[model samples]
Target: MTTYQETVAAEATIAEQAWAETFGRAMAAVAGCFARRETRATMAELVAGLLMEVDTRNCWTLGQALGHPGPHRLQHLLSRARFDHERAREEIARLVAGELAGQEVVLVADETGDAKSSTDCVGAGPQYSGALGGVGLCQVAVHLAAVTATMKVIVDRALYLPADWAADEERREVAGVPEEVVFATKPQQALSMVTGVLASGLDARWFAGDEVYCGRELRRGIRALGLGYTVGIAATYQVTDGAGHRWEARKLINKVRPEQWLRRRTGHGAKGTREYDWAWLEVRPDDTPGGNGNGNGNGNAAGAGAGAGTSVLVARRHRYTGEVSYFRCWAPGDVPLGTLVEVICRRWRIEETFQLAKGFTGLDQGQVTCWNSWMRWSLFSLIAAAVLALTAAAVHDGSERQPRLVPLTCPELIRLLRAIVLSPPARDRDHVLHWTAWRRHHQAVATACHQQRHRRHDQP
Candidate 1:
């Protein structure tokens, strides 16, 4: 059999092919904290585990790459993955910001709820899962993110609403919920995440999200910070037009502003005439979109960052393809209404990240139940997937016309990494010495990764 190494070299090799070098540096930065002794696993091995395992358990198998086996050292390196997330996010932001140095950037908020059996897990509760209706125990994390057409987005995130049981001293012991953790509203978490990104030195403006974070309180909070925002609002959320104006879509008589009052067909019974009121309004410093400090969007017209005496606001709307419902949009009067629309649309892309994280990076496949093991698996899995995504963006996504600010995606990146790691005649190469290059190259030369796709989930 022809060896992998020889086959790779025989094919047309690109110069610098520096992606491997870049990956190593990024892994080092991201995995710095997870370092144990020299005996512990390396970043490369952990990533391979993430990619191979359908779930988090692959983190345990990471030791296989280094010739280490069972009792997989899952705890030792997951800690390091935390640093990796921060670094990766920062790098992504920096790379993107550099690409659009003088252009506008959009921030979007969203959450994905995962249903689980345990109430002891952080934020676990009897919450509704859109994916699985009928109120199952679930957890949701709201991600506050920045996006641009040109670059990949990195969510500057904060995990949402910890389990109520986790905070209860009496239930703590039974459910394994940690004490330091506390219950938080998803919107509050979203704010913490956005501010966290700003603290990291990202000069971003313009934010958008679904109705979840577009509540009056959250919108008010964003405006108070002097940032521009656009978010979905409930149609029942009555807002007086311009200044102290107030009126609900149901009550307002006079105009077919359904264009202004954009509507989308929503809900289970939503059939026949389905549409939503997609409207935009301008809020003054003394005013808010949804009165009582409870609005979620910036209004119809998106505004910019506020200055002395001049307050800012946001605006925009979306009704989705299905579901008959009317969602209101809010933004300050001064912001560009057109740009707000662009920002709100950016949230759709983040879903792709989640999909890749699961199908490609093993976000949902971890089998570890140990406390230390859980944290390790969670952190490393995210990092590995992110690295793969960014790398692929750097190489394969060569569309010079589109915005190149965002990095490549996970699947594309992993293909390249594995190709190098398991390099060979990826394509178009003469057949010779199947074992020649592969055999000559010591197994130890290329880092051995965790046993992922190679394993069968037969263990009871």
Candidate 2:
């Protein structure tokens, strides 16, 4: 007779095996990116360390956790390893597309920043980072994420280089920035990544972003690709009505009749359903064939043109605070207010992706200072994150049988992997002594360099 405990144990074993198999396949997909067998092995181990519960997933700590004698091997993997990280990123996108085969998908554009104390790091400078809550010294990277009903994964990323950094040859050489890499605005980076992803055969119905992406060029580019968009806009942005009257977004919302505002639920939150009052007004498309006479950039002359999609300015008012937000929306034909609200809600999925990637896969934990090292570390971290996300989605799909159990989350899945699949951390005396010696040796070198600088200053 099969007892309850025996049944539970068998299920647990099956789950562990499934997760291990999925992880292996993900690593195998990127194996061709590395030419050397040695570097390939190091890359696998580095990804494993990122998945583990290391305090900080930088080279030093990750090397120690992986039972290496020192951090040199991992450091080489990040800096000078002969591997194609860009190709690996494309492989990741392919893997995700396969995993989300039948679900409806959308492309989401967003950016995240990692705070840096010093300016030596590549692309680090004073910038407006939501991660830091304001303008601060950080390295910001624009990312494009693919979102489905139950899954979200980052498909592409580009580091934002400030204007000053691009013009400074000395800093560029020191940081190993390529000559072709120049200053690109966040919106431009988003457009480039989106275009590349679409060209790579990833099908997406719509594109979504924040205000940074609501520019004339970006919107035009999105339309050219034949994808609908729902992007945020500032309150001060101007629009034109069918009667050739121009009105600011904030002022235009007041004209909406009291009964016209409908209460709609965006999605579920921790508390409950997130409901808000919504209203939309049809506006003019800015991507007309020729220039409009308004000179305000709104295509008022293209009103009711053949094959032109419906353009509208949508507004959402909070249920409690009454604070309103705005969005510029477009679809092939007229879409319901509910559809626009849903797209607006989906834009927030990228924020959740950033949080999960940083918390579970050490997305922002790299300590690299050069362009190549930073790119390699970020790509590997994202690969690790993608694997976790795919595994969790698979687990959640089979969770309906147990009504009492909550859906499997990335953090919880990681905890289970650490317990069952991953090897226990090495705590032997020899392992501890090895890492201790390595740290002290590096400390000595850094101290000597500082002392030499001080002596040179005194001599002058």
Best by lDDT: 2
When summed lDDT is taken over every stretch of 10 residues in candidate 1, the lowest stretch is 423-432
RMSD of 1: 10.7
Clashes of 2: 0
Candidate 2 error regions (>4 Å): 1-15, 288-307
> Global lDDT of each model?
0.50, 0.83
Model 2 earns a TM-score of 0.93
Residue runs of model 1 more than 4 Å from their true location after superposition: 1-18, 31-41, 53-57, 60-67, 79-103, 161-163, 170-180, 243-245, 249-333, 368-376, 396-410, 422-460
Using Cα atoms with residue i matched to residue i, what is each candidate's TM-score against the true structure?
0.66, 0.93
True-vs-predicted CA distance for residue 107, candidate 2, Å = 1.0
Tens digits of lDDT, candidate 2, 157-245: 99999999888899999999989999899989988888888767788879999999998888877877888899999999998876667
